[model samples]
Target: MAGEVRAQGAVKSGQLDFPRPLTTVDVVIFSILDDKLQVLLVQRPAGEGEPFPLSLALPGGFVDIARDRDLAACAARKLKEKTGVTSPYLEQLGSWGSASRDPRGWSATHAYFALILADASTLTSDARWLPIRDGKLREKLAFDHGEILASAIQRLRNKVEYTSLPAYLMPAEFTLPDLQRVYEIVLDRPLEKSAFRTRILSADMIEPVAKMRRGPNRPAQLYRLKKNSEPVYFVRTFNPPE
Candidate 1:
């Protein structure tokens, strides 16, 4: 009787695994260094139908239950194994397990995104940051990474305006000018210095740190995202255009 009840529950919840599907995860690692926004990509080796034998791609792989159901942890583990870098900000951006997203039999991969620390020059083992706008990126990837990349770019742009989340890409202490520079880089435009600073500070999403960053020109006060950080992630309501 209990077994039958459980079976009915599975049906109700759509939790039954009928055919085994190959599960995997792909991550889009991002960072800014030397005044440039760069992404980490792994070079695909010669393979069956992989377009570029030595092309670039984000680090990812199958989920390991032994590592726990933590999706971002799985991505970080795979990245360190494949690219040799353990980042501080790996997150499950969303799930992408559509049937057509993968060419391989019934396999589907979950894509994660991680923000990396600068100084990636040490990532020399077939892992490097090609500019997001690099014209040389024509390599065909394993899954729908091309489409995924496009979506991720839009997500980053949209989140920056309403969320102080971009600060994760910077150090614990940063100046308002530094923060605005990163915003411009991600948005790919020149933000009016006065207006940008005005809106950001008025948001009250960040608070001052005890540290001061000494620059070549002047010493700047450093600040960090405030403790009750929910205010920083405010998403204004919007109705679809009628």
Candidate 2:
């Protein structure tokens, strides 16, 4: 079938009547820091008329059909090669291709989105996390990456309201307040502490660990995602009072 052929990135005769589109992958890596949502970007080598030449762009690269197992493997490899960081969670955003999107030839790209904790020490050289607010990212990231990033950000906001996707952005152990801050930042609104806690508990999204974080004021209990807790859409969005 065509689908199977595409999956294996092959053709029986190793030839085709028509030219196939070149396949590449792009990744949008996101993190939360200081209550601001951030994205990782890399500086591209100098080039002529390139939107991001000698400037920041998303970490990405072409797929190696001869070696890569699949599109995801290509994305993972590229992310490590360009950023020296691995994501705790990575999901396919979708496919995109514009006739003028790439200059090399007719090209199509499969976009991926990932969530990771903010820690510059974990990143490779020349990679940096930048804040996203009021269309600031669009001006910096190049080659339709701004559009790709906007879609990724919107997906996160929509998913966090009904699903447990936010767990990917959290540490192995976190307190209610810590989780709440992540939610607040992603949702771009403040949530009532009591309501947020009650909803999370009722959903059974996380389980308490015996350990507690020792802090300045009080000891906060640690919690982690419940085993086998798969993401599910809620009947209504979670909008706690401010």
Q: How far is candidate 1 from the true structure (C-alpha RMSD, Å)?
A: 7.0
Off by over 4 Å in 2: 1-15, 47-52, 83-87, 135-138, 240-242
Weakest ten-residue segment in model 1 by summed lDDT? 233-242
Cand. 2 Cα-lDDT: 0.78
What value of lDDT does candidate 1 attain over all alpha carbons?
A: 0.67
Write candidate 1's Cα lDDT for 125-217 as tens digits. Answer: 777676665312355555677776766776776677666667767776689989988877776666778866767787887888888888688
**TM-score of candidate 1 on Cα atoms, chains taken together:** 0.75
Cα deviation at 82, candidate 2, in Å, is 4.0
User: For residues 1-242, could you state the per-residue lDDT of candidate 2 as single tens digits?
Assistant: 44543554445565743456777899998888767888888888786765557767788877888979999888888776755666457889998887567765557889999887775327778777888875246454667777788889888887888777777788778999998998888887878899778788888778999999998989999999887756755666765423
lDDT of 2 at 78: 74
Question: Which candidate has the highest lDDT of all?
Answer: 2
lDDT of each: 0.67, 0.78
Weakest 10 consecutive residues, lDDT, candidate 2?
1-10
